[model samples]
Target chain A: MSNWVLKGLQSGVVTTRYPRKEEKAQGISPGFPDIDSQGGDINGREEDVCPTAALYGDSNSLKLDKGRCIHCFRCVRNTGHPVSWTSGFEWASFTEKGTPFPKIFQKSLYIRVVDSGDCGACLNEVKLLNNPLYNMHRLGLFITPTPRQADILLIVGPVTDHMKTALRKTYDAMPEPKRVMAVGSCALTGGIFSSGFTSGSGVSSLIPVDIEIPGCPPPPLAVLHGLLTLAGRTK
Target chain B: MKLQETVNQMQSRWNTELKIDLDLSAGTAVVHCERNTVPPLCGWLFNTMEYHFTGLVPEEGTEEWKLIYFFTGEADLGSIQVQTSAPLNEETFQSVSPIVHAVDWHEREAEDLFGLVFEGHPRLGDFVLHDDAWQEGLAPMRSGFDSDLAHSQRKPKSNWKPRKVLDAPGAFVMPIGPVFSGEAESSHFLLETIGEEIVRALPRLFFKYRGVEKLAEGKSIHDALLLSERFAGTTAFSHALTFCTAAEKLSGGQIPERAELLRIFFAEMERFRHHIGIIEGICSSTGLVVAASQAGILEEKMLRLTGKLTGHRYFFGLAVPGGLSRDTDDEAIKEALKEIKGILHDLNTLEKLLKKTSSFLDRLEDVGIITPQQAQDFELAGPMARGSHFCNDVRKLLPYGMYPSLQFEVPCEREGDGYARLRIFFEEARQAAAFMNQAAAMIKPGPVYTPYSGGEGTALAGVETPGGASWQWLRVDKNNRITRYRIMPPSFANWHGFHLAVEKFAFQDFPIIKATLGLSVAENDR
Candidate 1:
């Protein structure tokens, strides 16, 4: 057991220098589809290829809704006129009625994670934030068990029917200076599980979403961006 | 026993002439029987013939409801499916749970989803859909039920209470989750105890049930594949592979050689990462902070490696009907194998230290024991059953992909304790790494994708996932649109036996025991 301490000390710091320095790891993110500069008309075939309707428009104009894009690469891989793919992890954005937390709660914030009906990928990525590499502790972010002590509510999954009340009750229990961050494509636009019988379209339908991190299951760095954005610390 | 031999014995013993259809290539025999003979047939198959009851798939027909019961034994015996039907007017059917205990949850699930009455099931409603959240009669899986329209919320059942069997002055029930700290998925547990020792444990899961099967009713094969992988994200590639194999079988398409080898490589990679995550969970549960963090770092490394090799961290959208959606570069595969070898060396050092740690061993040695007999009775799958010396691995028993050609050991432990499960996990991770190395070496240049013109038929495909054997049954129309899609995940089978390990253990041992089992709530809930 004493050797474990030596091993730990010898290994040194493996944590990413994110928010302090850029994490330039290759293939760290699956990336989102952007309309290519040499874009052609959005024909019937192009519009119908996406499984989630993330890419849709008339012949004159095409739209890419990053919230609904699961990064299936259908548009980029299977179409005649491909949408250019952009690879980076800083994809968190503020919602329409969303704002960053106040200055007082910026340095130290407690997060309450709620799994409304996630498929497990989003939650897995969220758990990885606590690992040695992407240690959120160094950034003054900690996960609290209860909502009363939490200043941020980090939610994953499209809200399922059975978890509706639990999610609502959890949101209501939080104090006034609370912000909600929805991670993963499912939590943003319900992704593939959208409009199902048992699940709501997304978390925003049940509660106001402050920050949106989109991907099928957003990579750990992207989720970190969401948290940093919530704390008003992201560059 | 061979398929024909079993059929002849059944006909002679029951003294009933049965209509049988055999597909030699697929190694399946379909036996049509009356509704009244369903119970006796299932009993004869399970008790006398020693066949393992796989699962029961209920399909809604225009005029009747058809129940397909899947059973398997040795690899040579293949699969036997008993087909029976009930009139639309008559909703009740005989329950086979009393005779075959493994059929309990399947019947309860069928009853909950289809509103079919299994006459002798001990309990039915409130299995998947909680009575507090849903009305009693709303069978979501029925054809008449709309998949798009959200039903009205029902009033919470004020009088609803968890089932309790212990009766004593100090007896009390403690409810554990639907929402837990950390990244644990939503699942509730009721631990009934009079003291530190728990007398009974009732697990109430499916708080995250998104009606995966119901949503897949009218979807095309491409769309349904997305649903299959998303339902359980940890073993995304395995489920996708299973779904693709079923689709391939239905269309009579063959996968290329290189694609098959690549499938095995990716599957083992997924298993290696999954077991590492489980090891991390066990370490954390036992309060070994440094070791857990080390394991977590290894897990993250594997995830990043997977993301580099395949576009997705979890190998979603990589598997399609006939073969893989995209081909992996051989140079990249070789490089990844080199990195994996380094990780394996570190894992070996960690395992040696963990074995010598007396505190960790003390907590795990005999804390939660599930005997081999209990494992068989509950039909537990994956490492959970292997830890109990069941030696039931789909890769060996029902070889798929390149498992038949590749050599690997299915490790087992006689002691069915938490320590045994942990050891099995480490050993399996080693074996998975070996498989990845071998598969990478065997890769040859070939077309990875084959355009399979979808045909109309029903087929069953099974794959050895990290958790266990996950079977997918697909029925498609002429237009390649799915009519019915059924997924029997390994976690669903293992959860039935989870209570066996938890019931007699102390309160403090619950988390460790659960960590050792490493069953996924989302997988089972789906």
Candidate 2:
């Protein structure tokens, strides 16, 4: 105990200088998967190995609905496309009419993390926003604890039977101009639990899933990208 | 050496068919058995030999329910998960609480969520969902808890009160809260006090029944990791790591050595920051601003580092199926390590100066004392557990990740009080520094992650959380989709230890007492 006090006095301020633009850091858990629907091979590998049925199969065309993508990287890991993640943490949006989507934007967006039927790994991505390194506040992406003040509801996990009601209630609790963005594979198409789900599936079946960010647990950066889309803050 | 032999002998003597399984692909293992046989096996492990009951994880299954008990060894990083099979009859297995005092809350929780009844539980009264609200016959854990039924029957929380002491001699009782101040989620505490000392501190949990366990049902083990992380937000990495380890082992996923090293690096960072944050919180509760400031700065620093390494301060998405989400470049890793090193140096000095401050010492010294006997009886873990003279560190006993290779010390004090707990955290942070530093130096340059697809398998993986060991059992059926996912976090076990501390301390010491005990509602509720 005595020694601990001594150590404390010596440590200096360790907070990050975020919005100040002191570092080219993209914040934690950032990811915006750029799947060139036009790139056939990249799409082929991604479609072949995608653990969840998130990637849509079309004739000579690759379509991606992030709302259902789990970002497992299995698709990217198997191929030779630049899979490097962008750390741009600035993500948020606001709308008085339809719900927003997760995208990179300069104005920032307020996202409310709702644990519908999530495994907790997805919830961690939502939490990364508050950390000093990503400093969602620095990018105007504020995490409103309650749904009322939020525009984009960051949904994690598939909507389990028990959570289905809670998920609806949470959305209902939020102010109108709300958009639902499913952040993990669980939230999109019920990714892994689709058939076995004892209750409901993704937000689309209940409310409306505007965008999906899929990954076993989407990186915080990817989560940021999802939020950016809803806010129309994405480049 | 002796312990291992004894464990092996017991495994043979019991004559239980042991189908050894290692999910080499995912880096995990499984040992399955019948549900009813778990207690006897655990008894042999804990008493006949030297294995300890680390945790009991329950997963939601449609046809049947699966429960796995993780046991730790004396040496070797080996862990055994006892898988017990039971038809979903809603019958609670006999309580292991009598054998491992840690299971008191675990059994109670099982009863509340799974609607399983532990017939012989010494105090099987409601620990979470009130006894009156849910009858012994009603199984809240069943798959049939329809939303319409749940909502239509959304019975209010139990007003079930403890045995009244108000009419007794030298005994009076009062309930603390379902709602509290200062960043605390809702929870109720009932105190039975005699004079100034507390006689019994009954913690009434499950104020916010998030139904996390029920929710993770039927999800693929990989996807379930997200839900596991949510079991407790502050220590999401531990749950995710633990769950992934189980899945990896079940699937025989081969984990790269480099990736394992990265896991340990981030894990240690998490341990340090959380310990610092927790202790600093303790200081703040006592109005020791200077100490609090020191701890706050360290915490803020840690959260910042967490953000940098994994891009989400808490390190989410960092732990995928087979490995981490990404690998740090050499230079980047060095920079991060250096930053941590610098803060740790300062933290060391700050600890010293604060100790010199008389005001801080007066308030902390002898504030909340838990004798060695009480400590052992309660079977506490983490700093609080160590503060009580129990030489139990799951990290050492149940080594995980690169911990078996890393050399570190487990700090202990016999006092078992708020001050001693705080001291243990301080010592632990220092020790963590050494461990993290060594890990960074030994880290081999290579891929930090390995992509793994699933197969039909199951696993029981575990990671040490600030609270204690977090266990997540994952089962993937023939289709490679997750069939069952169960989580057992340390906070569940810590409940018993917390009750011991609370029941003995004064009522006003509630804040400090709760702080010292350090149970996370979000984690436990999940």
Best candidate according to lDDT? 1
Q: What's the residue-level lDDT of B96 in candidate 1?
A: 88
Clashing pairs in 1: none
Model 1 C-alpha lDDT per residue in residues A88-198, reported as the tens digit of each score: 888899999899988888998999999999988889999999999999999999999999998999999999988988899999999999999999889988888886888
lDDT, candidate 2, residue A19? 33
User: DockQ of candidates 1 onward, in order?
Assistant: 0.66, 0.12
Report lDDT (Cα) of residue B51, candidate 2.
Answer: 57
Go through the candidates in order and give each one's C-alpha lDDT: 0.87, 0.63
lDDT (Cα, tens digit) per residue for candidate 2, span B1-526? 4434544565686665665465433323456666556677677666665555677777656676766677666554255667776677656576777776656677776776667767678776565555544444345556676534543454444575576645567677777654232224446677887678777777776544555555666566555666566446568777778877877776676888888888877877888887887776677777775667666665766765776667666665568778886678767778878888888886787667666767666666676776776655555556677888876776776576778788777788887777788778778888877777787888887876666766676655656777776766666788766655666766666766666676656656768767766567667656
- Lowest summed lDDT across 10 adjacent residues in model 1 chain B is found at B147-156
RMSD (Cα, Å) for all candidates, in order, is 1.7, 7.4
Model 2 DockQ reads 0.12
lDDT of 1 at B489: 93
Residue runs of model 2 more than 4 Å from their true location after superposition = A1-235, B1-50, B57-70, B76-93, B128-140, B143-149, B155-166, B169-177, B194-197, B453-455
| B123 Cα displacement, candidate 2 (Å) | 3.4
lDDT per residue (tens digit) for residues B1-526 in model 1 = 3877887787787665578888767677899988778888988888888887888899998899999999987767778899899888888899988888999999999999999999877777889989887778778888898665537545657678787889999999999988897778998999999999989999999998988998899888888888898899988989888898888888888889999999999999999999999999999999999899989999999998998898888887788777877789999999999999999998888899899888999999997899999988888899999999987888887787778999887999999999999999999999999999888888999998787668898999888899998998999988778889999998999999999998888999999999999999999998
**What interface RMSD do all candidates show, one decimal each?**
1.8, 6.9
Question: What lDDT is obtained when candidate 1 is compared to the true structure?
Answer: 0.87
DockQ, structure candidate 1: 0.66
